[model samples]
Target: MTESLRISSIDLAQFSESRDRRPTERIPLTTIIPRAWIGFSQAPWRFVGLTALMLITVTGLSLISKDLQQGEGWWQSALSDVLFVATIPTTLLPIVALLHLADQLLPSIQSTAQNEPVQERQRLRWIFRQTTSLVLLEGVILIGGLNMIRIIGALIARQSGVISTVVLLAGGLVLILWTLSQTLALPLLVHHGHRPLAAMEHSRRLVQNNRLKVLALLGLLIGVNLIGLMGAFIGLLLSIPFSALLLMASCRTQTPWVKDSRRNMLPT
Candidate 1:
C-alpha cells in the first residue's frame, strides 16, 4: 500500500490520547547524555555514515556555489537562482536522515535495558519519505516566518530605529520560543504518523510547562557541539549523533505516545 493510504488508516484519536499521556518529567541533561552514549554504542557505524554523508554533501554544494559565482551572464544568473532554490531542500537532507536514524534507535534504547524484544525496522523508503516531508514542512514554516519578521523589522527600521529594534528583538524571542515548543515535532511525526501541524501543536503542548528544561537541553546540546568544534571538527561525527540520540531519549521519555507505540510493536 502507498504511504498516504497507510497513514490515513492510522487512528489519530489513539495517537492524540497517547500524546496527552506524556509524562511531565523534567529531562535532565545528565540522564539523556549517558543514554545518547549508549545509543551511539549500539549503532556507531550508522551514525558515523550519516555524519560523513552530511559533510560530503555540504562540501560539494559549497564547491558548486563557488563555481556558479564566477559565471557572468543572464543564463548564469538564472542558473544561480535555480541552484539557490535547490540548495534549500538539498541542505535539509542530513536533518531528515538524522530523524530517520533517531526513530530507528529510540526503540532499541527503550527495550534494551528491560531485555524486551525490539520491533523489526521499518522499510528505509517509508522512513525516508516520512522524515523528508516532516523536515520540509517544518523548515518552510520556520524560514518563512523568520523572513516575514525580518521584512517587517526592516520596514519599521526605516521609520524608527527604536521601534525597529524592539520589533527585531520581539521577533527573535518569538523564534526561540517557537523552536523550544516544537522540540518534539520530528519524533511525534515519526512515532505517531502525525501530520506536520498536529505534531507541532502536540510538541508545543508537551513542552509548554517545562520550557526552561527544554532551553537547558538545547543549550547543553549546543555546548556539546561547540566542544566538538574544539576538536577540530572531527569530534562532530560522534557529537552530532550523540546529540541526536539525546533528543530521541528526551522525546521517548516525555512522550507517552512514543512509549505506547513501542509497546504495541512487541510480539503479541
Candidate 2:
C-alpha cells in the first residue's frame, strides 16, 4: 500500500509538471489542417456515417414540417423557430460524438493516457452534461441574444433603420466571435475531462491565445463546407467530419501528450 501510494504521488507530480510545461507549446498554422486530414483518412467511413445520419435526420425533419416549410403566418414562423431550436440538440450530440471519435482515433490528443482512464459510463455522463450545458448556454446567448436584438430593433425601428441595423450587425458579430471561441470546448471536454463551463473557459483562453490559428481554421472549414455545399449532400459528408477532425487536431497540437516513465521518477 505504501509503495502504491508513493507511485501515485510520483505519477501526480509528473502529470502536473507536464501540464505546466505545455502552455508555451504551439502547433504551426500550416500543420493543423494537414494533421486533421491524416486523422480523417484514418477513419473516413466513421466520420461520413455520423455526419450522414445527422444530415438525414435534420433535413428529413425540416422537409416534413409543412408549417416550417410554408413559414407564412406568425404562428407558423414561431413554430418554425421551435423546430429549429429542437434540431440544435441533434446537431450538438453528433458534434460531441465526432469530437469523441476523433479523440479515440488520435489518442495522443487526450490526457487520459497519462492518467486514470475515463470509463464508458463516465464518458456517457460527461457527454450528457456537456450536451445539456452547451444547449442551454448557446441557446441563451446565440438564439436568445438574436431574438433580443430583433425585439429591440423592432421597438426602436420608428426612430431609425440605421440604428436598428447597427444593433443587429453588432450583435451578430459578437455572437460569431463567441461561437469561434467555443471551438475548443468539446475537444477540451473529451481530451482533458473538463466540465462544460471549465471546458468553455479553457477553450476561450486557447482561442484568445491563438486567434490567428483559430481564425485560419474557421476560414478553412467554411471554405471547405462551401465547396461541400456546391457538391450537395455528398460534399457535406466529407467536409463536416473533416472539420471535426481538424478541431481535434488543433486541440492535440495545443496540448501535446506526455507520459513520464516510472523508472525515471524513482529516486536516484
Candidate 3:
C-alpha cells in the first residue's frame, strides 16, 4: 500500500510538470498551429474552408424570417431563406472535418527524387490527390447530416405559422449540441488518429472535465462564426486562420483521449 501511494504521488508530480511546460493558451492565434494541420488537413484548401463558413452563414440567414411580417416579398423571401439556411449544416460541417482530419492523419511533407523539379511537382500533385479523396470521403458525412437538418427544418416550416416556441427552442438546443460535437471531433482526428465520427465521441469526452473552457472556446468561436457569416459572403477568408489558431490551442490542452498535451513536467 505504501509503495502504491508513493508511485501515485510520483505520477502526479510528473503530470503537474507537463502542465507547466506545455503551451496551452486560450487565444488560438498565439498558438503555433502545426503547418501540416493548416495545410494538408485541407484540399482545394481555401475553397473547402470558405465553403464551410458560407454554409454556416446560410443557416444563420434563417433568422431573417423575423422580417416576414414587415414587407412585400416577405413570404417568398422567407421561403428562399429557409431553404438556403437549412442547407448550411448539411453542406459544410463534414467537409470541414474532412479537411481537418486529413491534415491531422497525414501531416508531413515528403521529398523524392532530389534535384529534380518535375519529380517534386509530380509528388506534390499525387499528395494533393490523396488529400482530395480524403476530403471528399469525409465530406459525405458532413453533407448527409446537413441535409437531414434541412429536411427536418423544412418539415417544421411546412406546418406553417404558429411554430411552437418550445419545439424551436428544443431544436436550437439540439443544433448547438451538434455544433459542439463537431468542434470536439477535429482535435481528436488531428492529433489522436481517431476516425471522423470517432473524433466526435472523443471531443465529448475531452470536454467532460473542462466544460467551462470548452464553453468559453465555443463562445469565442461563435463570435468568429458571426464574422464568418458576413465574411464568407463578402469573399473574405479571415476566419480560416482564426480557426486554425483555435484548433492548435485546443490540441495543446486537455482533450477527450488524453489530458494536458502541453505543460509536461514528467514523462508522458
Candidate 4:
C-alpha cells in the first residue's frame, strides 16, 4: 500500500494493540507510541510514573552541567569531565531500575513478535557500554593520545571564516542525522528486546520511506531537549516531565493493518 493512503486510513488504537499480537512483522514508531498513550492516559498514574522516571534522568543532566561550567584548568577540567561521565549512569538507571515501566515506551502496536527480555537487557547494557562506555573511554583512549589534534583543527578552522560557518552548518546537520540514526535503535532496544544491530536495522527498515518524517520528529525532540537545557533546574523540575506528557500525546496516532484486522473481526 502507498504511504499516503497507508496513513490516511490507519486506525491508531487497533494498530497499537493488534500489532503486538502478530508474530513477525515490523511495527512503525507512529503505531507503537500512540496506542500506549491510550491505556496510559486512562490510568494516568502510569504516565506519572513514566514521567517521573524521565524527570529524574533529565535532572541528572542539569546537575552536572553546573559543575562543567566551573572547570577552568587542567585539573579542574579533568574533574569536570569526571563529573560529566558520572551523569551518564544516572540518566539510564531509571529505565533499568523499573523494567516493568518500559512498556510505556513500547507501543501496544507491534507486528511480528520478538521477546527476549533477559537477552535484550544484556544487549541493551552492552550497546550502552559500547556507545557510551567510551564517552569515558573517550577520555582515557583519545584524550591524551591526540590531545593537540582537536586544538590544531580548531585553530585552522577559525581562519576559514565564512567558509567555516557554511561547512559547520552542513556538518552539524550530518552529525545530527547520524546521531539520531544511531540512537533511533535505542527505543527499540528497550521496548522490543532487540539486539543492538538488529534493533537498528529494524528501525531503519520501518523508517525507510519515512526518514524525513522521522527526522522531523527527531528535530522536535532535539528542540525540546535544547529548551530543557536552557530551563536547567526548572527544566528538570518540570520541562522533562511535561515533555514526556507531550511526547506521549504526540506519538498517539493509529496505523493501517490494525484497523483492517479490527474491521474484519468486529461484527457489524
lDDT of each: 0.70, 0.74, 0.52, 0.50
Off by over 4 Å in 3: 1-175, 225-235, 255-268
TM-scores for every candidate against the unseen true structure:
0.70, 0.68, 0.39, 0.48
Q: lDDT tens string, model 1, 44-84?
A: 99898888787777777767766877898777767767776
User: Where does model 4 exceed 4 Å of error?
Assistant: 1-36, 46-80, 95-173, 219-268
**lDDT (Cα, tens digit) per residue for candidate 4, span 1-268:** 5987778567665788787765333223443334444434444555456557666656666676667668676776676667676666766554443332433433443422265778656755664654344234434533443444445446658787666556556655654554555434545454555665665665555455356666666675677668878967555433344334333333223345654433212111
Task: Decide which is better by lDDT, 2 or 4.
Answer: 2
Top TM-score model: 1
Per-residue lDDT tens digits of candidate 3, residues 1-268?
Answer: 9999999999999999997765433322233334424543444455456555665665555545445435577676767666655554444454444434333333232213243878545644443444344445556755676666666666777776346444556666766665665565655454554554566665666666456777777776677758876856443345554554456346544222245433421112
User: After TM-score superposition, what is the CA distance of residue 136 in candidate 4 from its true location, in Å?
Assistant: 8.8
User: What C-alpha lDDT, on a 0 to 100 scale, does residue 83 get in candidate 3?
Assistant: 61
- Give lDDT for model 2: 0.74
What is the TM-score ranking, best to worst? 1, 2, 4, 3
Q: Can you write out model 2's per-residue Cα lDDT over 101-194, one digit (the tens) per residue?
A: 7766653433343434567657756776776786577667788878888898898788999998998898888888888888877777777778
Candidate structures ordered by lDDT, highest first = 2, 1, 3, 4
Candidate 4 weakest lDDT stretch, 10 residues: 259-268
